[model samples]
Target chain A: AQSVTQPDIHITVSEGASLELRCNYSYGATPYLFWYVQSPGQGLQLLLKYFSGDTLVQGIKGFEAEFKRSQSSFNLRKPSVHWSDAAEYFCAVALYGGATNKLIFGTGTLLAVQP
Target chain B: EPEVTQTPSHQVTQMGQEVILRCVPISNHLYFYWYRQILGQKVEFLVSFYNNEISEKSEIFDDQFSVERPDGSNFTLKIRSTKLEDSAMYFCASRAKNIQYFGAGTRLSVL
Candidate 1:
């Protein structure tokens, strides 16, 4: 079975500060990776995803993540974050094909942006 | 902008009672899924549906829980006898290929 681990439980950053949320996964083969953000009462919105090719994948909201195969990591990063960026972020993985293509999400990282 | 939509923002049901959560996925999406999240826990996968058949399910999706794509537009999750532990936010997700989209979610409370 595959699992995703987001080491940071909660992160607080001042507005305009650079942000990075670490994520690590344990899977046998290279899996489909994704980053999603959820507002306090809203649904999970996809920021970006990595299937193949580029190790550095760009997403919406000026956010990006790099997939390092050797390290089994897909970390989400933003050059500068705004107060509106404060929310819960999740890292997920899904299988390739026939084998139950459901996403397995990590515990999540709660981001708190201060003024 | 098309997105998944779930009904009843919040539902309060008694234990041993039956509850059905409804969802309307993105019109073009062919794959559908149901996931649950305990208040402070991770989002857990319950079942995945595609082409009118089940692709996969998790251990937490026991006999009490079932999913249906009854019509062309709707996919539903039915819990035969709800339990107290089942109180959580249930999210409906739809996917086409790798990108999976989610709805706001229905907070189910079993008392």
Candidate 2:
């Protein structure tokens, strides 16, 4: 089975500060990783996904994540944090080349940006 | 852009009653899925539908839960008997290939 772990339950970052959310996964094979953001009263939105390409993957809203196979990590990063970036972020993994599209998601990290 | 849409943004139903949550997936997408998020919990997959049949389902999708793509655009989830545990935000998703787009979700509240 595949599983994702997000160590940080809550993180507070000031505006203009850099932000990093740690994510770790347990999978037997090379897995497809994804980051999703859910704002207050909104649905989950795909931030970015890693299929098989470069380790560094860019996503919408100036967010990026690095897939490190050795560490089993796909940590999300943003150079400058904005107030609007405060939301709950989830890390997920799907089985590579599997018929089902089921995704195993982490508990999520709630981000808060201060002025 | 094309996106998945769900109806009844918030629904309040009594326990032991029947409730149906509806969704309209992206027109071109072939696979549809239902997920739910309990308060303070991660999103959990309920079921996946393809070719007018269920392709996969989680243990959470027991006999009380059922999904149907009754029409070309409408995909519905019917709960035979609702319970307080079923109260959550139900999300509908659709995918053409790898990326799955999600609907805003319908919040089901059981009383």
Candidate 3:
């Protein structure tokens, strides 16, 4: 079975400050990794994804994530955070070639940006 | 960019009543999925449909839950009897390959 873990339950950062959210996963093999953001009362939005080649993957909203195979981590980073960026972030993993494209998601981290 | 679309942005149903949540996946996508997120909880997978049949489903998709691709464009989840615990946001997704696109979701509130 595959599982994802996000260590931080909530993080508060000042606006314009750098932001990083930690994510770790346990899978039998290299899996398809993804980061998604959900605003209050909004649906899940794709932030970034890691599949094969590049360790550093860039996504929408000026966000990016690095896939570290050795540490089993894919951490999301942004140089500057905005008030609108405050939302819940989730990290997920899915089997590469599995018949069912089911994603296992982490508990999630709530991001709060302070002015 | 292509995106998935779900209907009934919000739904309120009484306990023991039936509710149907609908979705329209991206036109070219082949795989369809249904997921639910309970308030303050992580998103959970409910079922996956492919080739007009269910390829996989989670334990949460019990007898009370059912999915159907009745037409060329619509995919629906029917809950036989709603429960208070069923109050949550139900998201519909579709995948062409590895990346799955999601809809805004239908927030179902069972009272």
Candidate 4:
């Protein structure tokens, strides 16, 4: 079965420091990958997505993710973390040729930014 | 920027009571979906709706659950008999293409 895995359950980063959240996926074919961030009392916001082109995809809030096919990974990274960036991040995958494009999401990584 | 909207940010219900979660998807979107996340678990897909019919559903969406696009603007998920294990955050999403937009979920607490 296709699934997504986010290894880091919780991560703490100092404000202004760089950050990286790891993600791995298992699927038969090349699946569409995405990263979403959810703040308390808010909906999941699209951070970035990896489709057919460009290994590195840049998204809102200065977030970027790199999709590595050989490693079966799509990791999200940010050069500088902000206090407002403290939130839960989820990595999701959708099959390429599936009839109904239902998303398979990984257990999220909760990031806490320290001032 | 269009978005999907869900109602009743939080709901509390007794076991065996019926509960309906509501959503209003982006007007032009063609696909709709329901997903749930347990307190500390990954978000799981419950069902997908398109063209007023269910395109797909997961095992978690058993006979107790049903979905409807009542009036072209609103989509609803009804649980015939709520169970204690049904407590979770339910999310509504809509898609026009490859990207799916999510709404602020409704946290259901079944006591």
Q: Residue B102 of candidate 4: its Cα lDDT?
A: 99
lDDT of 3 by residue, A1-115 (tens): 7889999999999999999999999988989999999998777898999999989999999999999999999999999999999999999999856558898999999999999
| Candidate 3 CAPRI classification by DockQ | medium
* Candidate 4 local Cα displacement, residue B107, angstroms: 0.5
In candidate 1, stretches whose alpha carbon ends up further than 4 angstroms from where it belongs are none
TM-scores of all models? Answer: 0.98, 0.98, 0.97, 0.98
Model 1 chain A worst lDDT run, 10 consecutive residues:
A94-103
DockQ of each: 0.81, 0.72, 0.78, 0.82
- Candidate 4 local lDDT, A29-108, one digit each (tens): 88999999999999999999998889999999999999999999999999999999999999999974555799999999
- TM-scores of chain A, one for each prediction: 0.97, 0.97, 0.97, 0.97
| B1-111 per-residue lDDT for model 4 (tens digits) | 788999989999999999999999999998899999999998999999987899999999999999999897999999999999999999999986789999999999999
Scored against the true structure, residue A33 in model 4 reaches a CA lDDT of 96
Residue A41 deviation, candidate 1, in Å?
0.9
- Higher-scoring candidate on lDDT, 2 or 4: 4
The TM-score, computed over Cα atoms with residue i paired to residue i, of candidate 3 is: 0.97
From the highest DockQ down, the ranking of the candidates is: 4, 1, 3, 2
Minimum summed lDDT over a 10-residue window in model 2 chain A is located at: A94-103
The 10 consecutive residues of candidate 3 chain B with the worst lDDT sum are B93-102
Model 2 earns a TM-score of 0.98
Best by DockQ: 4
| Ten contiguous residues minimizing lDDT sum, candidate 1 chain B | B49-58
